[model samples]
Target: MYRIELDRDVCISSGKCVAESPETFRFDSDEIVELVPGAPRLPDEEIFDLARDCPSGAIRVFEGDEEIDVH
Candidate 1:
C-alpha cells in the first residue's frame, strides 16, 4: 500500500495534482486539494506522478518501509 500526505500550509491551492490523478485527489469547496480516505488502491507510479506534478510541492508519497519526497 502507498500513503499520500499533503502539506496544506505549503499547498498553493494548485490543481496540478488533481489533474494528474483525479481518482486520488479532488478540490474541496475552497479549491484546496483533498485526498480521499480509504479509496481504491493506487500504483506507485501514479502516486509519484501526482506528487511530482504538484506545483506547490505539498504532496508526499510513501510506501511500506520506504519514503519518497516528491517535493
Candidate 2:
C-alpha cells in the first residue's frame, strides 16, 4: 500500500496534481487539493510522475520505508 501526504501550507492550488492524477488528488470547494486516503493507487512510475508534475511540490507519497517527494 502507498501513503500520501499533502503540505497544505505550501500548496499553491495550481491543480497540476489533480490533473495528473484525479483519482489520487482532488480540489475541495475552496480549491484546496485533497488527497484521497487510498485512491490513485498508482504504480511506482505514476507516483514518480505525480511527484515530478506537481508544480507546488506539496504532495508526498510513501511506500513502506521509501518516501517519494512530489511537488
Candidate number of the best TM-score:
1
C-alpha lDDT values of all predictions:
0.78, 0.77
Please report the TM-score between candidate 2 and the true structure: 0.74
Candidate 1 C-alpha lDDT tens digits along 1-71: 78888888888987787776677788888877888766666787777877888777888787776777665
- Top candidate, metric lDDT: 1
Candidate 2 residue lDDT tens string, 1-29? 76667788878999888877888788888
Give the clashing residue pairs of candidate 1, or none. none
lDDT computed for candidate 1 = 0.78
Off by over 4 Å in 1: 64-66
Q: List the residue pairs that clash in candidate 2.
A: 54-71, 57-71
